[model samples]
Target: MLWRPFGINETIPTTIGALTVLVAGIVPWMDVLNIFDIIRGASLTILSTIMMSIVLESIVFFGGLL
Candidate 1:
Protein backbone atom coordinates (compact mmCIF):
# COMPACT_ATOMS: atom_id res chain seq x y z
CA MET A 1 0.00 0.00 0.00
CA LEU A 2 1.05 3.61 -0.54
CA TRP A 3 2.14 5.74 2.41
CA ARG A 4 -0.46 7.77 4.27
CA PRO A 5 -0.31 10.50 6.91
CA PHE A 6 -1.49 9.57 10.41
CA GLY A 7 -3.00 6.54 8.74
CA ILE A 8 -6.10 8.57 7.89
CA ASN A 9 -7.33 7.98 11.41
CA GLU A 10 -6.72 11.28 13.15
CA THR A 11 -9.03 12.64 15.87
CA ILE A 12 -10.23 16.19 16.54
CA PRO A 13 -9.17 16.42 20.18
CA THR A 14 -5.58 15.51 19.33
CA THR A 15 -5.50 18.21 16.65
CA ILE A 16 -6.94 20.76 19.06
CA GLY A 17 -4.42 19.93 21.73
CA ALA A 18 -1.53 20.48 19.35
CA LEU A 19 -2.90 23.79 18.07
CA THR A 20 -3.67 25.04 21.57
CA VAL A 21 -0.12 24.45 22.70
CA LEU A 22 1.23 26.20 19.62
CA VAL A 23 -0.84 29.33 20.23
CA ALA A 24 -0.23 29.46 23.96
CA GLY A 25 3.50 29.38 23.31
CA ILE A 26 3.35 32.23 20.80
CA VAL A 27 0.78 34.50 22.50
CA PRO A 28 2.95 35.91 25.29
CA TRP A 29 5.44 37.51 22.91
CA MET A 30 2.61 38.60 20.69
CA ASP A 31 1.16 40.36 23.70
CA VAL A 32 4.49 42.12 24.17
CA LEU A 33 4.47 43.31 20.54
CA ASN A 34 1.68 45.68 21.44
CA ILE A 35 -0.26 44.77 18.31
CA PHE A 36 -2.78 44.58 21.07
CA ASP A 37 -2.18 48.36 21.14
CA ILE A 38 -3.82 49.10 17.79
CA ILE A 39 -6.67 50.02 20.06
CA ARG A 40 -4.48 50.56 23.16
CA GLY A 41 -1.16 52.06 21.82
CA ALA A 42 0.99 48.90 21.85
CA SER A 43 3.32 48.51 18.82
CA LEU A 44 4.69 45.75 16.57
CA THR A 45 8.24 45.95 17.86
CA ILE A 46 8.03 42.89 20.07
CA LEU A 47 6.20 40.81 17.48
CA SER A 48 8.83 41.59 14.90
CA THR A 49 11.58 40.62 17.29
CA ILE A 50 9.85 37.32 18.06
CA MET A 51 9.46 36.45 14.37
CA MET A 52 13.11 37.17 13.63
CA SER A 53 14.17 35.07 16.56
CA ILE A 54 12.04 32.17 15.33
CA VAL A 55 13.59 32.39 11.88
CA LEU A 56 17.09 32.31 13.33
CA GLU A 57 16.21 29.41 15.57
CA SER A 58 14.68 27.51 12.65
CA ILE A 59 17.91 27.96 10.72
CA VAL A 60 19.93 26.67 13.62
CA PHE A 61 17.51 23.83 14.19
CA PHE A 62 18.01 22.76 10.59
CA GLY A 63 21.78 22.67 11.18
CA GLY A 64 22.43 25.82 9.13
CA LEU A 65 24.41 27.17 12.06
CA LEU A 66 27.00 24.43 11.67
Candidate 2:
Protein backbone atom coordinates (compact mmCIF):
# COMPACT_ATOMS: atom_id res chain seq x y z
CA MET A 1 0.00 0.00 0.00
CA LEU A 2 2.96 2.33 0.62
CA TRP A 3 5.71 3.30 -1.80
CA ARG A 4 9.20 1.93 -1.09
CA PRO A 5 11.83 3.76 -3.15
CA PHE A 6 14.80 1.83 -1.82
CA GLY A 7 13.08 -1.56 -2.53
CA ILE A 8 12.83 -2.28 1.21
CA ASN A 9 10.17 -1.50 3.83
CA GLU A 10 12.58 0.34 6.15
CA THR A 11 12.54 4.14 5.63
CA ILE A 12 15.22 5.35 8.03
CA PRO A 13 18.07 4.99 5.52
CA THR A 14 16.06 6.77 2.85
CA THR A 15 15.28 9.59 5.23
CA ILE A 16 18.95 9.94 6.15
CA GLY A 17 19.94 9.98 2.49
CA ALA A 18 17.45 12.71 1.73
CA LEU A 19 18.70 14.78 4.65
CA THR A 20 22.30 14.29 3.52
CA VAL A 21 21.47 15.58 0.06
CA LEU A 22 19.73 18.61 1.53
CA VAL A 23 22.72 19.37 3.73
CA ALA A 24 25.17 18.92 0.88
CA GLY A 25 23.20 21.42 -1.18
CA ILE A 26 23.42 23.98 1.59
CA VAL A 27 27.08 23.37 2.51
CA PRO A 28 28.48 25.56 -0.28
CA TRP A 29 26.78 28.57 1.27
CA MET A 30 27.70 27.80 4.85
CA ASP A 31 30.08 30.77 5.10
CA VAL A 32 27.47 33.18 3.82
CA LEU A 33 24.81 31.58 5.98
CA ASN A 34 25.54 31.61 9.69
CA ILE A 35 22.99 28.95 10.59
CA PHE A 36 25.57 26.15 10.63
CA ASP A 37 27.68 28.03 13.18
CA ILE A 38 24.74 28.03 15.56
CA ILE A 39 24.49 24.26 15.54
CA ARG A 40 28.18 23.37 15.06
CA GLY A 41 28.79 22.64 18.73
CA ALA A 42 25.73 20.47 19.11
CA SER A 43 26.50 18.57 15.92
CA LEU A 44 30.10 17.92 16.99
CA THR A 45 28.94 16.67 20.38
CA ILE A 46 26.44 14.30 18.80
CA LEU A 47 29.04 12.97 16.33
CA SER A 48 31.58 12.34 19.11
CA THR A 49 28.98 10.51 21.17
CA ILE A 50 28.13 8.25 18.25
CA MET A 51 31.83 7.54 17.58
CA MET A 52 32.45 6.67 21.22
CA SER A 53 29.47 4.30 21.30
CA ILE A 54 30.72 2.45 18.21
CA VAL A 55 34.24 2.12 19.69
CA LEU A 56 32.89 0.75 22.98
CA GLU A 57 30.60 -1.69 21.19
CA SER A 58 33.47 -3.04 19.07
CA ILE A 59 35.67 -3.48 22.15
CA VAL A 60 33.00 -5.46 23.93
CA PHE A 61 32.29 -7.58 20.85
CA PHE A 62 35.98 -8.47 20.36
CA GLY A 63 36.54 -8.99 24.07
CA GLY A 64 33.80 -11.62 24.11
CA LEU A 65 35.56 -13.56 21.32
CA LEU A 66 38.95 -13.53 23.10
Which stretches of model 2 miss by more than 4 angstroms?
Answer: 1-32, 61-66
Q: Write the per-residue lDDT of candidate 1 for residues 1-66, one digit (tens) a residue.
A: 365576754566578875787677955666555654564433366677788889988778646633
Local accuracy by lDDT, each model: 0.65, 0.76
- Residue 19 error for model 1, in Å? 25
lDDT of 2 by residue, 1-66 (tens): 377776775678778886787678854565535877888899999999999989988889546654
Deviation in Å, model 1, residue 20 alpha carbon = 26
- Candidate 2: Cα lDDT at 36: 75
Deviation in Å, model 1, residue 25 alpha carbon: 33
TM-score of each: 0.29, 0.47
